[model samples]
Target chain A: MRRQVMDWLEERTGLETAVNHFLYEDIPASAGWHQVMGSVALFCFMIQILTGLLLAFNYAPTPGEAHSSVRYIMTEVTGGKLIRGLHHWGASMMIVVVVSHMVQVFLWGAHKKPREATWLVGIVLLLLTLGFGLTGYLLPWDNRAYWGTVVTTQIAAKSPGLGAQIERLLGSENGVGVVTFARFYTMHVMLLPLLTTLIVGVHIYLVRRHGIAPAPNDTAPKKKFFPGQVFKDTVAIFIAFCVLFALSVFLQAPLGRLADPTDTTYVPRPEWYFLFLFQTLKFFEGPLEVVGAHILPGLAIGALAMAPFIDRGQLRKVTQRTTAWGIALLAGAAWAGLTIAAMRSTPPETDMHAGLVDAPEWQSLSPEELAGLGHFRKQNCHACHVLGEKGKAIGPDLTASATKRDAAWHIAHFKSPAEVVPGSSMPPLTLPERQLNALAAFMLQLKPGSGASLDSAPDAVVNGAMVYQQQQCGICHQANGFGMKVGPALNGLASRRKRDWVVKHFYEPQMMVPGSTMPPYRLPKQQLQDLTTYLMELPARAPSRD
Target chain B: MLAEDSETSRRRFHLGVIYTLMGTIGAALGIPAAGYLLVPGSSNRKEEWVEVTNLEKLKAGEPEEIVFRRNRKDGWKILSEKTSAWVTKKPDGQVIAFAPSCTHLGCAFHYDEKHKNFLCPCHTSTFDLEGKPLEGPAPRALDRYQMKIEGGKILLGAVVKSQES
Candidate 1:
């Protein structure tokens, strides 16, 4: 019955004939493992489309909600970590596969004669892949994404006469803000995808028209592609999938602190693929920055696009293509060298990621000190000064402020910044004496390695925060502005229950709150106590505005 | 044979006409889309004076970093952005406000009290109190904001690029 149905469908649409044409074509006998990269790349692209569409369902494109939405995906969605991880790793995998395909094509002199158009289209696809990377990176709206884009726009703004115009077009007139986010989202999910899909169709058509490039001086008879080359391609694709899946499961994608427009301290570094270009910019300073920014890169792309035309020799052997080989070798070495140099020169501090709020020692602070922390936030002190790992590092880090200055000095410096320390960029802070005293006290307590345990106050509250983060309670319950709203807001939990009751609730969530989606947090006694104390203190502590 | 050649020439001409029609349609759709994308980013921003601080608050010959918020239209959103400038009240009562970004690569420059110069930490680019590039990779003097003293309040306008060294 199935065979009869298939025959009927084939009679109407010629679907079976088309399948036969596609699957049973005569491939060059030389096309074995070497030709599998193209199929592998196509497989990765399919994965991207599937995963990207899944991501688009939940991803909020606006600047305000993009970070939170990404966090929502990572923490709240079912199998979100795996899904997002696959998408993240898949991007790099796609780039790797696509580049390998390109390299294989280049080395084999496959981009010659009738296949020149195919090579050209392949270059466009390669660029579109990179375009996908560039646009997709900003969707998370994290610190790295924000700063990396700033660097990108700045680089664009340096391109000779049309620099500012290009920057504005890429970002916006005012700078990277709402428009930039929308622009990138549109490009990533809409424009680029559409263009890439259409171009890829043309690319495949050309590839099919030309068939696979034969080996240099190949004498082997052509063979059917059905079982031999198809099997090799399938194996390669399966292996690629395994590697991608393993990476997705093991190494979760990083979500840095949210983007801060006022942050000038962030050292923006591009993704690894663009590191060579980033390093090259450092060499060409000031007037010649245009060379590194646009001119040289432009020339290279131009040369690559015109490669088939430039190297018109019929010979396919590497030995015969001396000039091409020489140029390609030098360029490859230089790119690798620059990328390595960039990697080596990157500062170690870029890896330092900290929670958005609350340092470890905050738990040990007096009420006055806690109030001072509030004052610090209210004053927007983080715009310039870094506390713990949070905030910009434009000014001296406040983590070791106590070791550097006495409370009296700090107070004096706050009152008359330039007078206390000449050439100080700190503006004159004219606060009431009480607030100043609280701020000074707060600063005095900030010593390096001053853990919450060091002080007598129930600083275990900070330790409780650590427990909360480690336990991933934020995935379900939100306190203040952090975490999702899947469960009840923990803002006024103390009002809802006593400490003992809260601790009991943690141990038996379903028992306390029937139909609670949250599973019981099987934490140690000390952790429960700390967590309860943190909840108890939540009422007194004001909700974070940011 | 001659009649056949004429027929082939007519066919080629028709194909050329078809391509030109297609090209015209493409341009009609494409040009506007390109403009739509580019125009928003490339619009000339109008400069307006915004009150920064009271003139009395700034000490003479000393630079004070003044932070203020400006409501700027960014695409569909009107966002209030926090921006700052290094304002120096000259001994002669001439208030000069330097753009916070350094002339070299736009990193935030801090006024170094010990060196009595503006220094950018990124490349160690230094500028004197007069905004002249004194040391390092700064290609020009520090750019200054156009300022007008209205009554007792110091208002800053557009940033004016300084002459390159």
Candidate 2:
């Protein structure tokens, strides 16, 4: 029944003859493990395409959402992390396999005679694979990706006359933004893939036409590809995939913190494959930067592409290609040396792990104080003012700012810097009152040796107490067994009424209690809330005093 | 005839071993890949109750701010984040806490003694004494924290992330 179906289909489509002809090629029995690299590369590419397509279904291209979307895929989506891991590791595996395949082809002198086109196409494929790595590296939109792209684009911008144009093309006129992300996304997912597939198709066709290059000894028997070569290819591919799978499981892909353009602390380094190029840039400075950044690499690639014509030896043996082999070995050694040097200069992964571990001092900060610290960093306050280990001493040290000045004073200083400190060069800040207060709260907690303190004044309550003092609520109300006997004693007010009631009473004193002598404070909503927060907590404080 | 039969059986045994090895390798690759695909789905966000401050140290009408560390395990990495909250003791001995984030654009709001209100410096949003939004662009009052008083200490629950407006 199956034979009849196959015959029927073949009669209609002529598929059986075409497939038989395509699969029945003869290869040299000497074609051994070395020939399997190409098939392994092809296997890795197929995996990349499958996993990349799955990832694209979830990835967002926009700068604002890209990182968060990747986080969602890694942490939330089903099997998303696994698919992402495969794709990530597949890229590295493809590069390794492709490089090994190229080296094999070069060493065996397979680029000789009529196979010049195949060799040239292979070089282009090598570059396109690297291009794939470069473009995909930034799609995660994390700190590492962002800064790596930044460094590369800056290198591109050093190419003399054409440098500016390249920079503008890669980075938008305003810098890396929506335009850059969209362009990279399109190239990574659409254009590069389509172009790679086309070149790969031509490459495979050429391989088929030329057949596997004969071994230099030329003594081995020729064998059919169906069982012999096919089985070997299958075995190599399965083993390669097993390695990739183990890597994906054990060494899960890293997802760094979300990209922050303003962050200056993060150290940026390119992916491992690009470390050689990145290290090359450090050697050339100022006027000669182009030599390392562009000219050298360009010349190397040119030499590789022109190898077939340049090395016109009719013999296809390793001994005959001594000059070519020497040059390849020298280039390989240089790349390995540079990559190792770059790896050593950078902080080790252990340092990054240590950074990820929480410090004990962090837990001592109140929520407001923590936010204030974030504001301090975000506002670039460290540029002038010294605070602990961070910031410069151009301005006065803020370690004791809280003891020196009250929350009200800090708020006033932030609004008008020069007014607070006569002749102060500090720029006036336009932050809202809330941020100013949070900043003040953070500053207050920065006393010397205060890191050991387990107890911290809650920022809201401190601010609330400040509000009570500033509003002179003590003039009419008594609290904690102090102040006048007029109105209700706020010390136990929270016990009798909820926070909302107190807030409403502040807004309209007559609404909650009839004919009350307490005048409406006409305070803002947040102030009322703060005052109420303070009033509500007053009872809790009273018991402690007792 | 017996010699030929033995030769054929030896070849068959070798072929069987090769095929079995290939199958075992295939399974070794396939099983883990399948497990990795299911990892994201099975993973859960870890939350823990962290100590904020001691209750005896909180004075009446005075709010004390405290920060606690929380660790989130993401695959092979543990991310430690410091979270802060405003803790206060009421006159009746009831303890209350609020997240430091303002209901507005999440700028930390602080007490303004001169204005007698909680003020967001970013947009000038004001909240009255009760943590109610009195003015500005804040959509609601400050978010409150889940609190537990135990063993002479105040422990704060996982921060209640306010829904983005």
For each candidate in the order shown, give its overall lDDT on alpha carbons.
0.75, 0.73
In candidate 2, clashing pairs total 45
How many clashes (backbone N, Cα, C below 3 Å) per candidate? 3, 45
Could you give the CAPRI-style class of model 2? incorrect
Error of 1 at A486 (Å): 44
Q: In candidate 2, what are the lDDT values of residues A191-256, reduced to their tens digit?
A: 999999999999999998898888777876787665556667777887888788788778767777
What TM-score does candidate 2 get on C-alpha atoms? 0.57
How do all models score by TM-score?
A: 0.54, 0.57
lDDT for B145 in candidate 2 is 79
| C-alpha positional error of residue A68 in candidate 2 after TM-score superposition, expressed in Å | 2.2
Query: In candidate 1 chain A, what residue range of length 10 has the lowest lDDT sum?
Result: A351-360
TM-score of 1: 0.54
Lowest-scoring 10 consecutive residues by lDDT in candidate 1 chain B? B36-45
| C-alpha RMSD over true interface residues, each candidate | 18.0, 10.9
Instruction: Output the chain A TM-score of model 1.
Output: 0.68
